[model samples]
Target: MTERFASLMERKLPMLDRLAVITARDQYVRKVLIPMFSDEALDSEVRTAFQSGAGGYIYQVDTLNTAELKLILQEYSWADIIEGEPQLFTQVFHVVQHSPDEAFRAEVLAEIGPYAERGEIDGQEYALMYDRVELAAGRQQLYGSQLECLNGQFDVHDLKDPEGVDARRASMGMQPLQDYLEQGRALYGPC
Candidate 1:
């Protein structure tokens, strides 16, 4: 088990590094370049580069997803991995979001909540996974912090059971929802 975990980490870390680079580059082209040069005005080479970058990032996402699926096929459970190797579960969860399996994400979400309750994983990681699973399922998010600016004002994605949000955040080592919202507004607002 130790040897297997070590090998998995060795492979995952490098792949994650490459994935981040390609994904960031792809985002830069979409968010930065497309705005600076309108879609029709982009040079062919620049356009092609953006297309290729997006394709490459998607390919990497597929590769990572397949790798994670293999890991899931193993006998390991979330608690086993979190208690033994710790960060492995978190790393897997990061790329696992790209996977199209709602059932699998739900499974992880259910399985990990107890571990988080036991302090097996940190609060931020727990909150992130919780918010992600909920949002992906088209349900309300627990943390009001996941915001996108609409008209320069930060708007909370629909939140589930908003009344208990601060307690949820506190349980997961997060600050109050209002405090997070304040920061989001300051950063994404003034409209």
Candidate 2:
């Protein structure tokens, strides 16, 4: 090894994890812009169409490319970010969980699967990660932990097996699915 590498090994400092930087940028976009605009709000960030006459309505628009441009940059950045081998997935996970980059968060969760399964990491984190990914993918979450309600009912997309999901959850260190949902309802108002 070179002298610099030898010194690095001795000190045990993380050598510039580019993935962390990428994750940070993505996180900023998610936490700031998406939440600020409620995702859909950005669709009409600078434009509104109102019917004036029977003929048609003109759109009051300004900087229509803003949101699209931001998304394009994010997508491009992700491609480059994934090109390298990421060593600091734990850090990446922290950044992603707080951010709305659900797809990237799911990717990080997938990377953590082996560690989580082997008891190297908290199973609750693993379960939450699994739920996040499923919810992101529009699937019935396996844990049935995270939930939302519409019309006084849990808005779970489509849970796979209502009968035995708890067994699956317990294997990954989670409460029984029914118990989880009941708690969820209590906390989130019948959701």
Top candidate (lDDT): 1
Provide the lDDT at 59 for model 2: 14
Model 2, residue 8: distance off in Å is 13
Please list the residue runs of candidate 1 whose C-alpha ends up more than 4 Å from where it truly belongs after superposition: 1-63, 70-72, 98-100, 152-154, 161-163, 178-191
Pull out the clashing pairs in model 2.
none
The residue-by-residue lDDT of candidate 2 on 20-132, one tens digit each, is 35555545544454333332333342322211221121111111222232354354433232223234444444445544556666766776677776666667767777877
lDDT of each: 0.63, 0.51
Which ranges in model 2 have alpha carbons more than 4 Å from their true place? Answer: 1-95, 153-155
Model 2 poorest ten-residue lDDT run? 54-63
Clashing pairs in 1: none
TM-score of 2: 0.48
